[model samples]
Target: MNAERLVRRMIDVGALRFGDFLLSSGKRSRVYVDVKLASTFPDILEMIADGIAEKLSGVEFDRVACVELGGVAIAVATSLKLKKPLVIFRKEEKSYGVGGDRIGEIRKGERVVVVEDVITTGRSALSAARRVEKSGGVVGAIIAVVDREESGREFMSLLKLSDLIKAYDSFDTTKS
Candidate 1:
C-alpha cells in the first residue's frame, strides 16, 4: 500500500490522532500514534509486520529489536512472522539484579533491526540502539509505525545506521 493510504488506515483505527499531546519522552505534538493499537488488532498487526517485512526482504540483517514496553510486542510479532530472533532494549537499567540495559538475546557482531511503535523526538530508539551496540550488536536499521518527523530520523541517521520511519499517514515528511 502507498504510505499515505496505510497511514490513513492507522488513523481510522484510532491508532493515530491529532492534539497537543504530551509524549512519553515529554515532548508536545500535534499528533500521536498510540502504537499499541496496531498490535492489538490481528488484521492491522499483520499489515504492520508485513509492511516492515516487505521493507526488509533483501536488506541483510539478523535479529529484530524493539524498545522496551511499547515496542516489544511488535518486535516479537515481526520476529515470529520473519522467523528470526527478537531482541529488546530497556528504557533504564532494571532496578532488580543484573541492572543491564539489554533484556533479551543479542550477540556481539550480530546484525540488528530495531523496531519501535512511534517516533516523536526519537531519542528512545537511539538510546536503545546505543545500548545494543555496547553489548556487541550492530544495529543495521531501525523501523517504526509513526514518524512524527520530530527529530527522530535525523537523530537515527546521526548514529550512522540505516533508518526507516513509517511516517504518520496524516502528514508529509518529504516536504520542507
Candidate 2:
C-alpha cells in the first residue's frame, strides 16, 4: 500500500489526531499518531502488514521481533505475511509465567528485524534491540509505521513512514 492511501485510511479511522498531547517520551506535540486504533480494523492492520512486508522485501531476517504493547499486532501480521516466526519483547522481564523479557522463541545468532508503531526517541526500539542482542539474536533493522521527526537517528538504523506522514500533513492542512 502507498503512503498516501495509508495516511488517508489512518485519518478516516481516527488513528491520526491533532492537538496538544503528551507523548510517552514526556514531550508535547500537536500531532499524535495512535496506530493502536488501527488494530481494531483487520483490513487496515493487513494493509499495514502489507506495507511493512513490501518495505522489507529484499531484507534478510530469520524472525520478526516486536516491542510489547504497540508493535504486537503489526508484527503478527507481518510475521504471517513473511512466514517468519514472531518474537515479542516486553519492557522488562516478567517475574512470572515464562519468566523472561521475551515471548516466543528466537534462536541464538538468528537475524531479527524489529517492528514498531511510532518512533519518537527510538529509546524503546533500541532497548528492545539490545535485549535481542543479549539473547544472542542479531538485530538487522528497526522499522516503524511513523517517525515523529524527533531525535534518535544517531545510533539506530530506522525505516520510517515519511511519505505517509507527509501525506497526512498535507491532508490536515487542506482541511484546516
Candidate 3:
C-alpha cells in the first residue's frame, strides 16, 4: 500500500484536521486525526488494514487484539487481511453476559499484537497489552493508525503512520 496515497485519502475524507483543539488527554494540539472517521470508508479501511498487514509481514503474532470502540473495525479488517483470529478487549469488564473484559478465544501464552486507531497517551493500547499479559498472552507489538507526535509512554515496539504523515505534508493533493 502507498502510505502517501493513504495519507492523502485520509485528508480528503476529513480524517485529519488542522486547528487548535483539546485532546482527550487534556493536551492542546494543532492537528487532530480522527481515524475512526477514516475507517468508516471501506476503501480507506482496506488501505489501512493492508498497510498494517504489510508492516507486520515478517512479524510473528498468533492473534490480533484490539481495544474497545475505536480499534474494533480496523482490527477486524486487519485480522481478515492477515487471516488471524481477533480478540476484543473492553475498557472495563462487562457487568452482564459473560461478565468478562475480553471477548474471543485467546490461548494462554499466545503471542498477540495490539491494534489501535490512534495513540495519544498510549494508555488504551497499553491497557489492552496489560490485559493480554494478565491473561497469560504475550504482547508482541502495538500498531496504530496515527501517532499524533505527542510525547507519551512508549511501547516496547510500535508501528505508526509516521511515513504517511510526512507524505501528507510534502505531497500536494491539489495536483492529484
Residue pairs with clashing backbones, model 1: 7-169
- Show where candidate 3 strays beyond 4 Å: 152-176
Candidate 1, position 77, lDDT: 77
* Winner on TM-score (1 vs 3): 3
Encode model 1's per-residue lDDT on 1-176: one tens digit a residue. 25444555555677766679888879776766677875687766777777778877876888998877888877887898899987777766677888766667888899998888876677878877887788789988877765656662442211111122234422545556
Give the per-residue lDDT of model 2 (tens digit) for 1-176: 76667778788898877799999989998887888897668888888888888878888999999988999998999899999999998887899965987889788999999998888888888888988898899998888877776864843222244555567777776565
RMSD of 3: 2.9
lDDT of 2 at 156: 28
Better of 1 and 2 by lDDT: 2
Candidate 1: C-alpha lDDT: 0.70
Candidate 3: residue 38 Cα off by (Å): 0.3
Against the true structure, what is each candidate's TM-score?
0.79, 0.89, 0.87
Off by over 4 Å in 1: 1-5, 97-99, 152-176
Tell me how candidate 2 scores on lDDT: 0.81
The residue-level lDDT of candidate 1 at 22 comes to 89
Better of 2 and 3 by lDDT: 3
Q: Which model scores highest in lDDT?
A: 3
Evaluated at residue 28, the lDDT of candidate 1 is 74
Instruction: Give per-residue CA lDDT, model 3, range 92-138, as digits (tens).
Output: 88899779888896789899999989887887888888888988999
| Backbone clashes under 3 angstroms, per model | 1, 0, 0
- Each model's lDDT: 0.70, 0.81, 0.82
* RMSD score of candidate 1 (Å): 6.0
